[model samples]
Target: MIGNKAVYAGWKAAGMPDMLNGDDHFAYIVGYSDKTVHPQNGITRVAVATIFFRLLTDKVRDANSTLTNNYSDISRGIWYDHAVSTLSKMGIVKGDSHGRFGPNAPITCAEAMTLIDRVLNRLPESRDDLLNGMIQWSDNTDTSKWYYLVVQEAANSHYDDIKSDHHEKWTKLRDTRDWTQVEK
Candidate 1:
């Protein structure tokens, strides 16, 4: 499990869109009521969903917040309801065969990679494209896993294009965006 500080630093380094403004500080990863972030502990599925949703541009969040999903375990009007629903509507998330989204479960590496790839619209053209000396996984020989390709693509791909495209598309929207509109 990575720390919240590390995640924030990585997000900044990746050039991902943010909602912060001068004298207005915000954090996607909030601490518990006790004021401890528990950075070493594994993050839950619901927490990951909320973090990803918070990372989106305000325009995108408003446009997709009303979307719905059929995850039996998720109750409407909960804290993570909108995040899960919007991500599901955008095809960034999917439930299991029993239609259950284990919100309390710890997010797996494969699930995280899949979510990130889907958000960035990254799809490798060929297996060879992911093996150009960029990926250096210890278990590279384990090709039978369902998330093998996505993990490889994430490790090999660069986020410069994604960062540029997001900035270009949302610059105008960001100038007049309102964070108060969304339910935190």
Candidate 2:
């Protein structure tokens, strides 16, 4: 319930419908229920919800800006309008060649990675050293698999272990875990 309302409020605070995306998908304003499911032509609540949360993340403020919106699409809900515009402006997403962001489309790994890369750069100069490399630009060493190079550089700088990526050690990427309390 809170998530749904937060999404709605976020969109309203920005603008309304954004014409950048032609998607006139349904808005999950009414909080999700057990029976709720995406029909043939509907957007998932997860994507919408995550975008809402991202607005409140530390990265947004670090960008030296606040989320703003302007309604370009009249058919979509105010929620979609605001979310799309804000996302596009943030450079996290973009419209196709025809100048229309496909709001209903599922975001891909490349897009998520690009967004996170941008956020990493916006961290404060006083942020933990572990995150410093990301803030300070570095010379491109390895061209192929730039992402892999980044992960390796992070390890070399003592921020994380190299095993995180090479070992497919996804567990290490978690924000929280009861490693001390987990039953073996």
Candidate 3:
């Protein structure tokens, strides 16, 4: 079975408070509790999804703190609740047509790319050039596919308009060169 050390390290690196020692809620909120343990070898998809959302929005929060149960699949008090709610409110992510977030389901590559694109677009200093560059995926560019345009924009670099903004400052965490080389 995989140990908890990696999750602990990730939690700390994401600026989460170091309260995993004895706080059950903290561990669960950050997805590091004993319940996250996987007997086979790896963490569950829900656990990873919770962690991913936490890492992405650790430095941000919705002031309202309203409980928007947008997904029937995600219950209240789960590790990913607030993060998912906030992201959903910001339109960075969305549930399925049937109103299911499927928190436990593994995200497909198309979904991952679409999420990345949407987040980048939400950034104040979005790299439109990089996003509109090219079509990398050979098979998934159908306009009907939800991820078609997102993948195309994520793989291309058509604009170079640069400006200063909070998103620009935040995106500095990852170098621009990396986006230029996004996988097809």
Candidate 4:
């Protein structure tokens, strides 16, 4: 977002609290929890895996990435570290310059769009496979709202069960032109 107000409106339209302003953007993802989940130090391994599994669908045939093993070694730092291993294994996320994914850092809207795009790209593609995926989870130069494009793609692809919370943002964004800020 170019300005704080636009970013604030976009997040608010994306079903976030009005109080979450820029630099405070990440509060939308973690602030909802009564307690803060530290990406490297505060989060649990199992907690991250569970979130990844929820994004899986019928045709996502990645057995190795299923993460059904003893993840005891990874309870190291931050909540997103767990997400990195599985998501990276699934070819969805990557880390830092030294190969470290800052799981605790606040992600910008553009980066979030690209991340969702990467995950969607990994899914198996087949004709009429409704359960395969949906929304425009790509970083199209023309996609007015990259976030909504991903959400809509998930919906269109029939990605089994995204929490209704994210979907509700789509409705509000469609109803209001609040997402334009991200475009600017």
Which structure among the candidates has the greatest TM-score?
Answer: 1
Rank the candidate models, highest TM-score first: 1, 3, 2, 4
TM-score of 3: 0.54
Off by over 4 Å in 2: 1-54, 57-77, 122-184
Score residue 105 of candidate 1 by CA lDDT. 95
How many clashes in each structure? 0, 7, 6, 18
The window of 10 residues in a row where model 4 has the poorest summed lDDT is 166-175
lDDT of 4: 0.40
Model 4 residue runs over 4 Å out of place are: 2-53, 58-62, 66-82, 122-184
Winner on TM-score between 1 and 2 is 1
| 105-125: candidate 2 lDDT, tens digit per residue | 665433444444333331111
Candidate 1 local lDDT, 1-184, one digit each (tens): 3333211112233544333122324578887899999977888998998887877777677877764789999998887899999988877788888999999998887788777766656654445434344545887557666777777665543432234333211111112223346424
Residue 52 C-alpha lDDT in model 2:
44
Tens digits of per-residue lDDT, candidate 3, 96-145, equal 99999888676665566556555444232322323333445668555566
Q: Report residue 1 deviation for candidate 3 (angstroms).
A: 25
TM-score of 1: 0.65
State TM-scores per candidate.
Answer: 0.65, 0.35, 0.54, 0.35
Give Cα distance to truth, residue 83, candidate 1, Å: 1.0
Error at 169, model 2, angstroms:
25
